[model samples]
Each structure stands twice: as structure tokens, then as C-alpha cells.
Target: MTFPLLLIPGLNCTERAFVPLLGSLWPLASVTLVNHRRGDSMAAIAGAILAEAPPRFALLGFSMGGYIAFEMLRQAPERVERLCCLATMARPDTAEQAENRRRMIALAEQGRFDQVIGANFPNTVHPDNVDSLELRDLHASMARETGAETYVAQQRAILARPDSRPDLAGIRVPTSVVVGEADMVTGVDGAREIAGGVPGAELTVIAGAGHMVPLEQPDAVGEALAKWLRR
Candidate 1:
């Protein structure tokens, strides 16, 4: 049976983050782009999405969205027909990572939001795409749409997020884990951890891409997701 697909975008991102892959996925099932920017906590965000979501859906969560997906599963596992996590880890924030987020939040609060987004852009994609003006502009535009206040709230939520690694094996849905080979933010190791933890979960590692796998390698991601959907 086919289930409606629910798409969740990452930090400082909107539905635009998944636009590139919609063409390939639209034919597979009904698609819903979720608004994850309304809440400052994962529970709140996931709860809000669940409240407005279809009774059941195939969930695809990108980067920070993956974290929310885990929370959603905790809150309502029966509603998720399948799961796909893209470029995100099942771990909680490390001390260093939390400190880094705090620093970015401080910068955004000080009216240097653009600077914060600009500095983080390079790490989000492959080295080859670092200088691609088109990708850079798209990233910047999405960040702008997300805005500074929401950025801070997202950072806070990310920092406070729980470790989801423990819950991985408990997931019973058809699951797939996708990541970029060169993803420094959430590398193959993280993907492997999730894939290994989840019974019968498949892992797809796209070469020459980074954390922004959906934007950096949409075709490959679409293909991988299509396979997951078919299963």
C-alpha cells in the first residue's frame, strides 16, 4: 500500500530544500512539506507536525529534520509507515557542538545572522560546490526565509535534543539511511551507525556530495528514496 510522503527540511531551511527532488518523488506518492520552524523544541515541533499530518506517512527527514523524525517516532511510531534519514546522526549534541551552536546563536542575536549563515554554508556541501554561486545563493535564500529569530530557536532545540541512537533498533518501519561520502557534518560513520542499528535498514552513500545531499545530489537521493518507497 502506498503512503503519503512527509518531507522535513533542515535547520534554517524551508520546503525549498527538497524542491529539487520533488519531480522524481511526486509520481511515487502524495507529498507533504512540513513546517518545522514553528517550535523551539523537538517534541513541540514533532507534535505540531503530527497534529497536522495525515494519519500515516512515509517520513523523510533531512539533516536537522532527521532529529525531528526521531522525536516523532518516539511520540507516535504507529503513524510512520517508513523512515528515511538524510545526512543526520542519531546522537545528541556534544559539548563542543553545543558550544558552537551557542556561538552561532549569539552571532545571530547580535544581528550577524547573514554572517553566521555564510560561514556555515561551506561546511554544508561538497568542496566542489563551495564556490558554486547558484548553490550558495539557494542556501542563503533558504536561510533568509528561515530568518534569524527562528535560527536561534532551531539551534537551541538542536542543542537540547536527546540521543536517538538508543531508539534506532526499536524502529519497525521500512527504513533507509542516506548520506554524502564527503559529509563532514554527519559523515558515513553516522549513517552506518543508524543503518546498523535499525534491523533490515538499507544505507546509501552518495559520492562527491556532503551534508546537503538533497541539494548537492538530488538525482542520486531521489533514486535512493524511490527504492525505499518501493520497498
Candidate 2:
């Protein structure tokens, strides 16, 4: 059986972030890439996405999108048929993490957005792929396209997002937590935390990948998502 799939991209990431997985997913599902740049708060962003989303659909959220996903589940648990959290965590940002985001926002505001994007590009992929011009350029392109304003807003939203740990146990839908074994941003421990909280949630750790697992190891990440969608 086939169903609608709603995808929420990460901070400063456009639909381009999921392009690699689309080939494997297109035939198995009706996919929609959500627009999450319009709102400054998690609630506002989730509400806007829900207002335009299908009545019910499989939901996949990556990075900051996971925060919005939690908010959506809180607002309308009945609307999500299944959930996939990719390279994300259920906890709110730590003080250090929040500080880093503030620094990035400041850099963006100072018209050094390119530097901010460049610095983050290497962290998105595994060390082996850090020198890959293709991945680096793609990351930069996506960030530039997303623009500084949206980037700042997303950083702020993520910083202010509520801790989703308590709500995980209440999630009734089928759930999958996918993360890169080498993820520097959220790390495997974070993924484990989410999987442990959600009843019967499956955990997929993709080796040789990092924060941007979908792009770093497209085939592996695609297979993981396809399996979850089939389940």
C-alpha cells in the first residue's frame, strides 16, 4: 500500500536536502517537502505545516525539523500515521549548543553568512567526505538559498524548542529513529535516547555517514527510510 509522506527539512535546508532519497522513495510514496521557514516558533511552524499537509501522512523530520515534528505530534497526534526522526534528538539544546547557534546568527547578521555555511558544511558529512567539493557546495548552496533571515529564525526556533523526551513515551504511531554513526551534531547517543523513550521505536545507525546522512550515504539512508515507510 502507498501513502502520502510529509518531509520536513533541517535548519537552512531546502527540499534539496532530500533529493538523493527521492529516487528510492518516489515510487513507494507520494512525497511532499514542507516549508518550515515562515515561522519563528516551533508551534507556529508546525501549525502552518499541518494546515497545508494532508489529513494524515507518514512524517519524516531531519535536524531542526524533528523539533517541529514533536510539536506537530503534540498538536495533532492522530494526524501522523508514522514518524521518522533523522539525525535528530528529543532533547532541547544545551547551553553550549544554544551559544553556538547564537554565534552563527551573529555571523549571518554581520554579512559573513558564507563563512557560517562553510564552517557547518564539513560537520554535516563524515571526515572522509569533508574534502568532497560536491557535498560542500551543495550544503553551501542550500544555506545560501535558504537565506540569512530564515537561518537565524530557524536557529532561534531550535534553541527555544521544548524538550520532547517526555512526549516520546506517549507516541502511539510506528516510529523510527535514524542517525549517522559518525554524526557530530546529534550523535548516536542522542538517537539512542529517543529510541529508548519511544515504545518499540526502531533505530537505524548508518555507518560512514554524519549529520547529513541522507546526503552522505544516500543509498544507505534511502534504504533505511524505504524500510520504515514499508513498515
In the order shown, the candidates' Cα RMSDs to the true structure are 0.9, 0.8
Worst 10 residues of 1 by lDDT: 91-100
Q: Judge candidate 2 against the unseen true structure and give its global Cα lDDT, from 0 to 1.
A: 0.92
lDDT of 2 by residue, 1-231 (tens): 679999999987899999999999998899999999888899999999999999999999999888899999999999999999999999987888889999999999999999998888878888999999898888888988999989988888888889999999999888999999899998899999999999989999999999999989999989988888887
lDDT string, candidate 1, 113-171, tens digits? 99998999999999989999998999999999999999999889999899999999899
Best by lDDT: 1
Backbone clashes per model, in order? Answer: 0, 0
Query: Clashes in model 2: which pairs?
Result: none
TM-score of each: 0.98, 0.98
Please give the lDDT score for candidate 1. 0.92
Q: C-alpha displacement of 112 in model 1, angstroms?
A: 0.5
Instruction: List candidate 2 stretches off by more than 4 Å.
Output: none
